[model samples]
Target: MTATYQELRRSDLPSLRREIRAGHYAKHTAGLGPGFLQTNLAIMPEAFALDFMRFCQRNPKPCPLVGVSDTGNPMMVTLGADIDIRTDVPAYNIYENGKLTGSREDITDIWTDDLVAFALGCSFTFERALEEAGIPQWHIDHDTTVPMFRSNIETVPAGPFSGKTVVSLRFIAPERLDEVIAISRRFPLAHGAPLHWGDPEKIGITDLGAPEWGDPCEIEEDKIPVFWACGVTPQVAIERAGIPLCITHKPGHMLITDIAEDAEVPVRNPRAA
Candidate 1:
């Protein structure tokens, strides 16, 4: 049976994690676990860990590091009590020499002693906040993943990681834009506030109907598109870097952590203020 967002949202974290680990759920985790924090996953060889860590540190907006596992260990203690990086996420993208090879439900076969796992904050956390604040998410309303695009803004580079920023779009009624921004600003770990709103072209996005990732959402006549820095920014950087091998959660398919969405996250970048 297909699980509705409401059903999954009310489901316990342990059960959801178990279902995801068993490969029974591979769908985008938008409204699932309504008040729990969700994250983007990145796993790479230990040889590239330092450089990737530096990359995340430099590009904090799009790659806010929430949890990092010890080399070769799948347990992300900081994020959850029993979260296993190897099978926690619903899907994983496999990359080789900077190209996408395939996707898998589990990467235990490729898991090696020299690999490191990273968990980056995702905007889904703030989407719930928006909903709680009375701002409806059009994508979630229509049961679609949020639209994401590659933007014109460039990320600060670190080692082999460098690429244009990627952002997720959500249409907001003009009158409520300020309220949405205010609600989002509270979640600094979740790409705090809007990066750009009103014009997509100003950010080099040529078409609102076409998104680089996820389903295209309807932009009602009264609404304007608002953009937020996306966790996929690191995936773009990883692909461009052409690292020997890399793995990340397939876009939209995130790792749902046990942490509460409203839990206070220390500001890793004050400039976001």
Candidate 2:
């Protein structure tokens, strides 16, 4: 049952996961499953679970806590009935001693009893809300990853986890800024509203054309740059921790959950074109 990208965008949660689990999709999950909740994955050893939870608590803007898996279990019952931490996401980043070892579609080979999975609320959830409100997302429209940058702001330390916050960028028309902020504010689990808009330099982001992760977005004279607390902020902390092992969903490669905020929205298959 092969489905085109346009088909998958309108697919039900289960059908999409089937494709992802089969290793058929391993890319940024921005426009797909637009109304449902999405999570940034962070699987850490049992020993670091408590501290990581605290870290999320201290920095809810970037690390909004959504669902947490049992210490040894791969299933995320809190997020969805069928969410398997190992194979559900589009891609996984494997780290050893705080270094990125590799990235792959599945982590079943390394699944262990001591690993605990965390589902951090992602801004992808809000991007859909923005689009629904008629706010444009340049990166999604261009089929590119949203640019992410590190800000000078520091997160409150939780055990050994502490670092500057990361932010996801989008350029939206100046006239739509207030309306977009209102729409995005509705999803607390999705990082809830822009942290800052306009001048990127105010946030300590010196370079607008270059980004620390994801693709650089083209500047538009009409649209102002908007920044939102990014779920990838945790990955920076994970890397700085130097833990023996850590696994995270690659930036923008999120785990889609069944929790729908806008299920009533109708989807059309653009492949009909």
Candidate 3:
């Protein structure tokens, strides 16, 4: 069956993951999964799970630990119903020994018994909330990838997982800056709030038009550049760790979950059913 964006948007948790795992649809999930949780994915070897978890604990801004699968299991049942780590995301990036090897729609070939999956909450969820609040993201409106830059900010070091924090940039009207920050801070799991605003160079971003990942958005005359911690920071960290093998979702392509918007950001560690 053909899966339309509108159809995907309203699907319950198990149904959405099933559709993604089927491999027929592969597209940026920017505006879909309304009022639901969408996540950034990282699958790593068991050897690095403890250190990576510590890294997330120390650096909550860039690595808000949402859910972690049991060692060697791709099933993220804790996050929602029927969530599979293998093929639930739209796309996947495979890295070998600190270098990007290739990307795939599914990683059944590389699936191993030593792999552990981690799901990080994404700013996309908050961006959706902002839109619902009547504040639109320029990247979403322009149909472009959100601009991301490697910031000078360093994440707290943990074992082999330590690197510069990457941030997503958005251009917003000065009048809406207060509102944007205020609303975003409510969703702490979704990168919760902005790390910096106004000057890009202060954060080591030299060019606003050229992004390290994804497409760039225009900074209008009336709008000022705003930045938020991105979940992609782990991709950079995995490269630094120089692990033998790692897998992540492609930029803009994310794993949409069954958790409703209100349930997306965890209020407490509710045990998986």
Candidate 4:
């Protein structure tokens, strides 16, 4: 029988990590490991790591850094004791000369001493929080990956890292918006709260049925579309920067960390006054 989200949610962190490491689970990680943190992965040469780090620093909403690996080290000790940057993620996108070349279940062959890996907080963390708070996630209800789009909002540039922001969308009843925001605000590392909520066109998203990444979710007549800054923003920057080589976890496929969902993350208010 196929594993249900409930069953997966009850799974232990180490076992799930091992399954992902062994390439036994390569699908979207949205509802899995309910109490653990899930993160977006970015691996690139050390030469560009500083600029990318600065880029994340400048755009905290879209690229909040949760963990950074030591130069040439695959272990992300801060996130987990045995997390391997090269193989722990279910899948990875390989980019060459700023374009997607292919994807791999593991990148051990390309791992180099000059490489650096970064783990960015993903919305999955806050999504779990939302679920726990009784806020319905349309995508999860429909068994689809959350829809994401590239917004018109531009990110602050750092060296070779510059691009428009990317966001994930969820439909929520107007009455529940405040409650959802309150629950999500606690996770500063998880992109905080919604970036925009209402019409998709306002964010340069032309079609609600068409997303730049992930699956399109249903929007009920009584609900409004809500957008949250997505870690995929860095992938857009990498493409625009034309970096010679870059690797990121495939959209919706994330790196699961041992960090607890309720663990404290540095609080930086991303909301505008």
- Estimate the overall C-alpha local distance difference test score of candidate 4: 0.86
lDDT of 2 by residue, 226-245 (tens): 89999999999999998999
Quote the lDDT for 227 in model 4: 91
State which candidate has the highest TM-score: 1
lDDT of each residue in 1-273, candidate 1, tens digit only: 545566666787778888888777888899886777789988999999999999999988899888888998988877877788999898899999999999998999999999999999899989988887788898888878899999999999999999999999998999999999899888777888889998889999999899999999886778988999999999999999999999999999999887777667722222211
Candidate 2 versus truth, CA RMSD in Å, comes to 4.8
How high is each candidate's TM-score?
0.94, 0.93, 0.93, 0.93
Better candidate by lDDT, 1 or 4? 1
Q: Against the true structure, whose lDDT is highest?
A: 1
* Model 2 regions lying over 4 Å from their true place: 1-3, 262-273
Residue pairs clashing in model 4 are none
* Backbone clash tally (model 1): 0
Which consecutive 10 residues in model 3 have the weakest lDDT in total?
264-273
lDDT of 4 by residue, 91-154 (tens): 8999998999999899999999999999999999888778877889988877778999999999
Residue pairs clashing, model 3: 13-258
Model 1 earns a TM-score of 0.94
Candidate 3 residue-wise lDDT at 236 = 93
Q: Tell me the lDDT of model 3 at 119.
A: 86
